[model samples]
Target: MSVTTRVYVARLAGTAVFDPIGDQVGRVRDVVVLVRAKGAPRAVGLVVEVPGRRRVFLPLTRVTSIDQGQVISTGLVNMRRFEQRAMETLVLGELLDRTVRFVDGSGEAVVEDVSMARQRTGDWLVDQLFVRRRPQRVTTLSLRRRGATLTVPVEAVTGLAATTRTQGAARLLEAYEDLRPADLADVLHELGESRRLEVATALDNERLADVLEELPTDDQVEILSGLDRDRAADVLEAMQPDDAADLLHELSDEQTAQLLELMEPEEARDVRRLLEYEDYTAGGLMTTEPVILGPETTIATALAQIRRQDLPPALASMVFVCRPPLETPTGRFLGVAHFQRLLREPPHASVGSILDSDTEPLTPDATLGRVTRLLAAYNLLALPVLDAEKRLLGAVSVDDVLDHILPEDWRESHDERLDEEASRG
Candidate 1:
């Protein structure tokens, strides 16, 4: 239960897979970590099985020790999987290290991570789990850091823990299992601010970016306040410019000035540009991170660079031909083409050939009404914003526009409003 102590110890990776070990058996299917809790983190436990492989269960009992990041099962399962399947029922911390599945009265999903909770009598229960994607929401939660496009319920999970190893390369990938931004937002709301700071400080930068994007503006401010100005700036800096500006707009000017001063000058200038736009307009709302190209660059070279840099989903979909300025693009715009079109069409084809000249881009100062209409008419997720000389300024995604205009609770509360209007009519 010690926050700083090693919950589970392992050698392969820096930390343990499960705190109490006995329940991890049958080649550990998963380790579920409930990352949405707003209070002290609350997690669950699970295990998975295939056609010939029978599942194992790690009850709250049997797990006695946690070291590093792996659970030590002194109960029935022993420590790690050793190609043994002889059924041995245990009594005490007897479940220690034994592979076990949760009989949730429902079926089992993969377990992701395990956490310890004290019961009324001061005994610990192996209570929390981080599961894999057998449930759809778990997949969305898992990709939170990857910037996937789907929104998950964060509510389908009922049962999970850290008794099993996750897939390759995602060693610490337990938290996002079935986690929802709204649920995480609620947890941030519940943590009474201080705890929120504590958790955010401990998370990695990429994780902080994901969680910050999910949090309400108020929680975002509180968490930022707890961090050193540089670290806070770093978190915001990692965000897409538009998303970072969304949070900055919520802060006092004094706070805003302090945060901007703390950021890298180039990054600060880019974010500042977006901030100067009206809070809801396309110019104000577009991501400055575009897939820009110099007039002299070849389609082949542009394609290579595009594959290398992480692109905004919009620009990746629509390749804009222009020169790169400090943070913005320059030169007269040559319109853009779908990247796929460029690839399928030919490598030697000039960007001029691929350009879709008919779709007129908006200026950075374009109104939301104009931007929204453009999105609808073009049936596009995003559009390029041009400056006075028809230079590519930035691009706005439809998702960004919706976020700028809608209430955060729109998803949860929209249904009730519809019902009320029906009743009124």
Candidate 2:
């Protein structure tokens, strides 16, 4: 059989790279491909990782043979640093796990993996894409569906090249928009360290913030610690104050302090306040991003803000009327305007005239049991947490309260689901 039909890129990724005389050069870190208008992209070179040295580019033409888990080279390696060019694509880094739309408009799928082969003309081609279709959901819980894998030529897909290749962050997030944060976090957690970092590097601060919020504390710490200081600060700033505080509390005091110093002063202050509360208290479980509005704000305006911001379902259930500092903890919290109430009233009606101030707000130090009773008795989705002076600190959602009441092994059950996915793969 010709080399083109013999081996796959996945199998060659970690193979040893050796020189002509059998001297160890390095190991294959990534495969570089030059994308073109038609046909599979031409594999241009290999990114070789040498211990205690920068990654270097090894041109494919200099490769003698790939046999028995070893890549024999012609002793003509490029010592210059391997910076990816405009047309070059890193198969392992960029192509794997990417989502592409079918050119025929049938549907979209994720590239679970890929296959490549060397041509008779001494060129390597990306021969096939191993795609996994989104599983169909059944109305019943008894029957589970598994994702089906499809083998397709790269030419039949769109949304995974050009702009997607150059701006990897956008492409990485495009396929995952439909997923809930918890599901997305599960996917990221199952990936190996290198691949996890590759995907993380491609997500913007806000999107990464949502995913990190759903991850376990240990995984959150690991991912945050791995990022550069500036990016880490930006991501932390984007997270809800309670989530950010919980993650920071898992780190050593020194690490926490360092990150806090890098964060925006206002956001840092909010996190600091949340950190002061006991982990089991209402303040600790509250999110600072509540839908607060002024007393005189019109019902239509409040509704518009909720729609424009795309607030979480819990927070969007109601709007709190407050004095100032709309985005963070602020002045006197007057009352709340429920979504259902907004719909009943005229658009020009002021929220203050129809506020629901009947439910007593919870104090910062309120116990989880107290919070649960207050929510259950009043049938409320969220309850505001206030300070001694009645300032709106944040709001504890029903979901956070449920997290405490649920069994401790709830997370383990979630991980088992991912394990089943791996088994199926």
Candidate 3:
């Protein structure tokens, strides 16, 4: 086995990034990892803040050495602007300073820092954590003694959860950081009523939106009901319109209208459009944020755009081409260019020239069954959904389709499997 180097994720923040030749490049802003359903997530890259320029992604492959408050890299760095996607997890922004549960279910503790390492596999793992335990109850007998800080292995963390239900509980909810939103939602579903509300109340809008999408309609409504009107509106705004609309469709008109009225007009408008469609229709399943491009764009420029956005692997596999005004209900839908085709072509090749226009796009009103069949027939990961005027609206990904087709109790069954694995471990 190869040697490993221990490093704290927090200490790396603000450390200088240097080229192999000893020239300074930037400061580390955050560490990016691909969160998995289990096991430690591999650190894929770093978000570095370059002086006078936008933050950029520095992939781990480019990093030659990391020590002494500096990260040294030997490879040519891509200066493309960095943007987080659905799959990239920010350690400092989302994980550090959060609370986690002990493996033995003894009590909760605040995470002071994450201990990561470059392992024998040549990957960075969140190997350990520095945590400060919370006192069970404040008493005169323990007044002089505060919670003690201890180094604990990541494996000792059972879940990201908490017994305390304060407004600050959200910070404690990070104990479930190892889990994906779907898995976390399942855990939330299984918890006792008060504990469930405490955890739900703690999650910020974005995280809550992710968890809500994975929850059943009834569960979604229950969680939303626990939050104040403003928070409920914010969470709904953070959710994808189709998912938000579906959840809203399950609520009483009075409740739905109240939340909508509290939301920003622009966001509420999008949800309203989705609500107009039947729950099983194409319009109801599509996400408005597909990678859209003009016909005249070159392969090189397209690749840069893809890197800049850091799209989820599946959505990044292809690019949609459209006419001017590249927004939803955009100018007429043109065609699509696969990433593989882009690679095979000259860097200067125009996307229009390589467009695959043979595939039939789905209309917004297409039934779920029809959408599924078309995606399966073409072996497409995502299909464009258009309007009557042939304007591009959104793209329905295969994952979304699978979400609808799965059994109602799928999340529960998956949760049970996860629980069994935890027991074995």
Candidate 4:
């Protein structure tokens, strides 16, 4: 590969990787390096995430160019999945944000980025680190500058090898800020257990709740357990009632009750109600927080509510029209007003005027099989679950139904299996 004099590894993240013929293969997720006992780490390969979210190793030898915005390869790529080895370190994932001190004992700095340079023998090595100096304590009232960022030879820093020191995740989190919750969960799943918990703890409650919902049940429980009880309860309150209930199901009854007790009364009540249902039933797969509007709500108001960026696509697909009480277990169920219908109607029209009442709503006791079939038969994204009294209890989204029907370990195994099969082919 034609290497530039120096390339900042962090800047290469998410850059497209292409084959010799110019066909894009995947994107760079991280850099793999072999840390040596006495010198800079040797640049081994790139962690490229291909289609289906399978990350594979692309050795540096196969890379033809590492130009701006893209990395061109020799077209021979291994389709097998990448798994980290014992002696390897992921520069972007592990090194960034590490607390280190200069050899001269001036002060400590946080590793912001690392640069790889071609050696005399033609091998690329991580030779320099871009770091931000930690602010020094000041006793005077005079204004002092914040920590300044600068590049220094990697050998000048200490503490990078110490696993005991607490590492900050700010730089890493900033690098992945654009990733979707599911993608971020995938990234988190690949980290070591301790590191995973560290990053999870760094995220705010709402962001962490979104990521937790996308993670496997085991990961969700582990990260939640790592947090203090109060914060854990707050995160649970932020998650969708059904998802929070599912995660709680994996914990001990005592632990679940404690967290529930700490949650807001109304939020905990919804989760507790969901926990009462059998796992394979519609009630267990539904979220109690779908958009609900009374009969007199106007099309414009309904449109505004559904336009909320926080609503999941399936839950946002339609608004459940009900009577007086709009919350779950709402007063008498009217029907649903699909988003498309609202867009077609005048802003002044009431949602009740254009309801899709023909489609029957499922009872909470309905089987998963029944819910799946009804969704497929109606080509619906979400279906409302009603009580025998015809009050809307919650909405069963298609995504939730799929999550239940899939194998329990599907999140952990699905992509790996796909990559294995591709390699065999």
lDDT of 1 by residue, 54-127 (tens): 22344333444443444544344322211112222111111112122334433334333333454565344344
Candidate 4 yields a Cα-based lDDT of 0.89
The alpha-carbon lDDT assigned to residue 411 of candidate 3 equals: 50
Q: How good is model 2 by TM-score?
A: 0.60
The digit string of per-residue lDDT tens for model 3 on 14-129 reads 78888878999997777887767678767788878665433568888778888777888764766655656667766765555556788798887777777788877688888788
**lDDT winner between candidates 1 and 2:** 2
Q: Output the number of the lDDT-best candidate.
A: 4
The candidate with the higher TM-score, 2 or 3, is 2
* Candidate 2: tens digits of C-alpha lDDT, residues 303-323: 997785647777888998988
Worst 10 residues of 1 by lDDT: 89-98
Tell me the TM-score of model 4. Answer: 0.94
Sort every candidate by lDDT, greatest first.
Answer: 4, 3, 2, 1
Error of 4 at 355 (Å): 1.3
TM-score of each: 0.57, 0.60, 0.59, 0.94
For model 2, the local distance difference test gives 0.76
Positional deviation of residue 238's Cα in model 4 after best superposition, in angstroms: 1.3
Task: Quantify how close model 1 is to the true structure by its C-alpha RMSD in Å.
Answer: 16.6
lDDT of 1: 0.55
